[model samples]
Target chain A: MTSPEERLQAAQQVLASWAGDTQSPEPNRLDVGVAAQNLIAAIEALIGARWGYLSAITGLDLGVEAGQIEVLYHFCEGAAVLTLRVATPRASASVPSVCPLIPSASVFERELVEMMGIQVVGTPDNSRLFLADDWPDDVYPLRKDAVLERGVKEQGNE
Target chain B: MSEAVVQDKKRFVVPIGPQHPALKEPGHFEFTVDGEIVTGATVRLGYAHRGIEKAVESRNWTQSLYLLERICGICSHVHAMTYCLGVEKLAGAEVPPRAQAIRVLVAELERVHSHLLWLGVAAHEAGFDTLFMYSWRDRETVMDLLESFTGNRVNYSANILGGVKCDVTPDLASAILKGVDFLEERSRHYLNVVTTDEVFLQRTRGVGTMSKEVAERLGVVGPTARASGVARDIRIEAPYAAYADFPVQIVLAEAGDLEARFVVRIKELFESYRLIHEVIDKLPPGELQTRMPRKIKAGETISRVEAPRGEAFYFIKSNGSDNPERIKVRTPTLCNMGSVVATAVGHQLADMPMILAGIDPCFSCNDRTVAVRDAAGALVTWESLRQRRLAHQENK
Candidate 1:
């Protein structure tokens, strides 16, 4: 059996144009930094080659000091996990949706937008996923600066 | 026929739940039906959302275990077990082999109960009450064993940070064996019934059939994907904890219909039975708990477990604090919900319940958003409803 690194190497070769600054933080996992413009191209290469299935799109707040939000698109095949890390400015963070290529990615993309407040441009469904229907606009709970009071609607006297 | 009438086909929108009797949980579905055939379908979940993910952020490392376990009452053990494994991995705490074995034992036991519950619910969805009664009655056996072992029927808090809290005694081991023996026989009988029973077969076989390509493309997980012959069992693909020591076999069915899902889950019970017995016979000897630090090292890691529904993915990022920085839990039901929505299209409106139930969805586990009817009496997207709220606030 080929090693996880070798499989990731194959993915890298396919995504040679967009793949940059690859890092293996742990065994059986690979993380690659991809430019936002080429995010879809890199994911297309992985899915096209059947490198793996789109596992989860994890959105991270890099804290206020960093002023950036990191979105990790994890693709898993067997024990191997390949992550495409894309960092966007926290002020106006946005990433293109991979839903056009992978239909299942829509759920995670919607979640990414609603929970982390990062915009997934071109996502078919940009509606609230896990949040209550009455959750306020511009109040994303997962962001470091988000105040819980802003998101919750105050109850009126019946 | 009038020309204006032909253009306006009068497509009726059949709205089901946030509190429908057909569904046990609170999920609103709007199905656009042209006569009996459903043209389009949409689902709104979040009715059961408790913000458990955000709630976990406030609690300390150990306290979050109990909170996370309550995320899903059916597959509670695996939820906490997966969380502990991720936290432990970041903390670099080595759980004892025996603890790992016991954890797997509880996990497999939980799978048995969960799959049996799904069987009962699926049967009920098909209007087969007798089978539902029989399966739930049989499910008590596993539930009883779990209670005896963990002192709780639901939300078995069997796992702690470093290791499992409970140890399997000789009597408990024998009790588990007895339960497995009875379950194995009952599972075989149910399998025969599902595959051969005429009434049940009519409702299941050749109904809600999803091909392998669709299953892969939609990224359906667990038995739902397995029914489509997608070998995506995390336990088999990437064995963790005791699974590496006592591996599990993957169960697959090609038809990808309601029947295939039934068969896949029932067959998995047999596999679970085999694993339970194997683990008991070769139960490792070691301590029950390990010494874990109060504050974990600053790091991030991923943990995937083959939950009864499908693959439960967890991403835990700790920041050298008593509490975790962020814990992202992507339950299997979330991944499988899209498949249910996709499969609902092109099916008879009457068969919608069975098709929805085919994936064995747990709305409580999957709920993160809500849906409501618009003032115009038309189904509206959650976004539009939220926009109305925003507009009202601005005017005020």
Candidate 2:
């Protein structure tokens, strides 16, 4: 029932303590940049206040040139959507798990782990969620330059 | 199959499928059971994961629209519609009011067919074949209307990037009105049958009753959340497409059981029928196609639409080029899948099929036949298997 602007303002206040830089790319959306250390605090703030449901988690590869991956946690309330953005260096891309707070988030976290090769620290399940068993380790399928197949040794009825 | 996944050697865990667990879809579930009662459960999906999100990155704007529509066979229009709305937002393109209304019309038609299909499937799961047969038989009216109107039965490619591709002629409008009139009467009859049928009620009444708190915590969407009083329909709350022009009343049920899910979805059928008639009567006059840029501006946008299942969420990012930089799709089934695992913990194994059908899980939207293997793990040939079955039939 509340307006999208009003909901984003409320979310902005709740996440103010941890947000570094904030931007509104569209009218109904708010993007907040949060440090990796403060990620849980920001998520807890939104969920604690019942701001919205955790909609989806998007893993964006800035590219091989940028050597950084940005993890966006999107939360939607009616018409409003608030995203908590965290950028990690590609070499050491890791974010603390939010599954301790929201159990349903394990699916999203698993996706980030398998697709972007990001280390989701302390997630409840660390197994492969989508990739095949024979899929080589350290090969993330969603990376910008990810090869479809390479280094697959044939097993001749071993 | 192993103690590692279950984490206890003494425990007896029953793995339902990487095959048909209940519905003919491909999802694997492990239900930890003691006697007839289940204690805990886990589900493994992606048996048919097509990886559309990754595939779209290599495609241009126009090409991806067709590819995204293949995400689900049933609710194809919503995917194309969601992508177009996000792309239009990024390009700053304006679609005509008539085009928007047509989009809603096709969307509502798609919803009608989806709900009726779910009704038949749910009935079949409950071992009520008469309802299954009757509902699917009546579903042909909407299916026929869709085929005649949109030119396809399943993937009605009715949407282009800027606007819609189909137009409703006078004859098409009359046909739709007549078709939906029949469907409305059939739907009313179904509502009575589901509410009053004592045998059907026993299978659905109190099974998998999730409280409002659990529903929220699990974060179910669409009819599943609405059945538990979540009040989170994107059509009403956000009003994408022409939903603003023609308002949608959010249907709600507080029981949160399998029966509540049935009732909520059936009630939503009536809402779709009403919207179809409204859009046809107040059909705006304008262009169906709007000019749009091949290269969208550099911006990131989120588009959400209320699909028949729930909120079909698409996040689109353009890099000032023809192709997209990144696109993420989170289907409603992905959001509501967790609830099935959580709710299956305390029910009898016999009730598993109905409880699983309660969510109307669409695993990858692909259909296939079962692969039967013998005791020694050798695959059974279809011809030999068929002949053996025929011989046994004659012997019995």
Candidate 3:
């Protein structure tokens, strides 16, 4: 059986070949978007269903300085957790939803949509998860600029 | 009296509640009932949504620990442990061996409390108030033990960024052992009552049955999945904290019913006692916590810790700031809630409470509201006349 480090190395090697980038020992800081797609394909091909668990999906907003959105995919290979990072520019912050590949990704994507306001292209259920039905379309509380104090009207009120 | 009754009646929609006596939490569940048997059920959540994920963003890293701890009062320590693990991973901090051992001990203690609490709630749903009182009385022992160690019972914010905030002295360890001993003796009696009590058994056994395959596909975790024979305990599979050194056995069952889930959790209480004793015996000698840097470097780290409920996950993204760039938490209840819908499908209307409690549903931690949709896909709300009638009348 290959060690976690060995498996990670093999994954990076395949990704480096596919993306035509210099193979580095650390794949933690890899760029997001296209590079992420290549890495995802590499992992799916190498590990297959053995690493089928999409444990969680996390998104982070890097303000105007970087103007980027950081998305992390936490996957489990048996007991070991391997995280894949993908960074996207804030202006066109979009990433392919992995729910089609992993059904568990659906909830995580819903959370990401409500929290970070990032567009998950082709997600089947993009409905509001933790927000009120009457909540304004443009408001997302997790974003840096989202207003927290704007309360919704009581149920009985018109 | 000889009038012919109309047999072919149309199905009527009944909304359970955003606030119903059957459900402890505030979330609406609409069931399409044909007399007593339910044809279809749709759940609407988010009534208790306080925007926790959004609240975490505004707080600093240290302050978030307290905020996260409040995610669920029952599994408070678990939330703190997961959040601290995330920050520690991002900062590349290694906890001391003693700290790890204490963490495992406290975590297992919390598990005992959570399971006992669920058992009480399950008993209440079955209308077995005697069992509810007994389970809660036994649960007080664990809470007292926690309070002795961490200064509080519910939100024992014992976990810090690098390691635990409090240390277990010899006296505290002795106190914990005494509590464990008491719980062990009481648990045997509770187990007998849970398994052999006729009414309890009748209400739970074969009711809310979720097949192993459906449980897996729905991603159910903790005892709910274990009862269905999934064997997916995070503690046994991925041992973090002191669990890696002193492994705790994962209790499992194949029955896939409310009774099976109850048995699995009851057995886990004994396992937790054994683990606490093992940790106390092998308590390592080292510093409690490692010093974390003031600023975290630009990097990302994801960590998974076995919370009392199941798998509690945290992913942290740091941008060389005092505050985190992003922090995401995937709670165990979120995974278990999916199974509620699958298991409740064919169950009778009267059995809804037991089925709902079988998953040990924690909507506060899961944070998703219920929205009722009609057969034609039209959204329905309390303003609908059908909902008002159900609220006023007790009988169908």
Q: How would the docking of model 1 be graded?
A: acceptable
Off by over 4 Å in 1: A150-158, B1-10, B20-22, B368-396
Better of 2 and 3 by lDDT: 2
Give all TM-scores, in the order shown.
0.91, 0.92, 0.83
TM (B chain), model 3? 0.88
What are the lDDT scores of the predictions, listed in order? Answer: 0.86, 0.88, 0.75
Which digits, one per residue and each the tens of the lDDT, describe model 1 over residues A81-127?
A: 88899999999999998989998888899888888998889999887
How far residue B82's Cα lies from its native spot in candidate 3, in Å, is: 1.6
**What lDDT does candidate 2 reach at residue B360?**
83
- Per-residue accuracy of model 2 over B373-396 as CA lDDT, tens digit each: 578655565356778899999999
Could you list the iRMS of every candidate?
7.5, 6.7, 8.3
* RMSD per model, one decimal: 7.7, 7.6, 9.5
Best by DockQ: 2
Q: Model 2 Cα displacement at B320 (Å)? A: 1.0
TM-score of chain B of each: 0.90, 0.90, 0.88
Point to the candidate with the largest lDDT.
2
- For model 2, name the residue pairs that clash: B17-B28
Per-residue lDDT over A1-158 for candidate 3, one digit per residue giving the tens place of the 0 to 100 score: 44555554544554454443332223332322336556447545534534435677777777767788777666654454555667788777788877655555666788788778888987767876677888778776677656544342332222
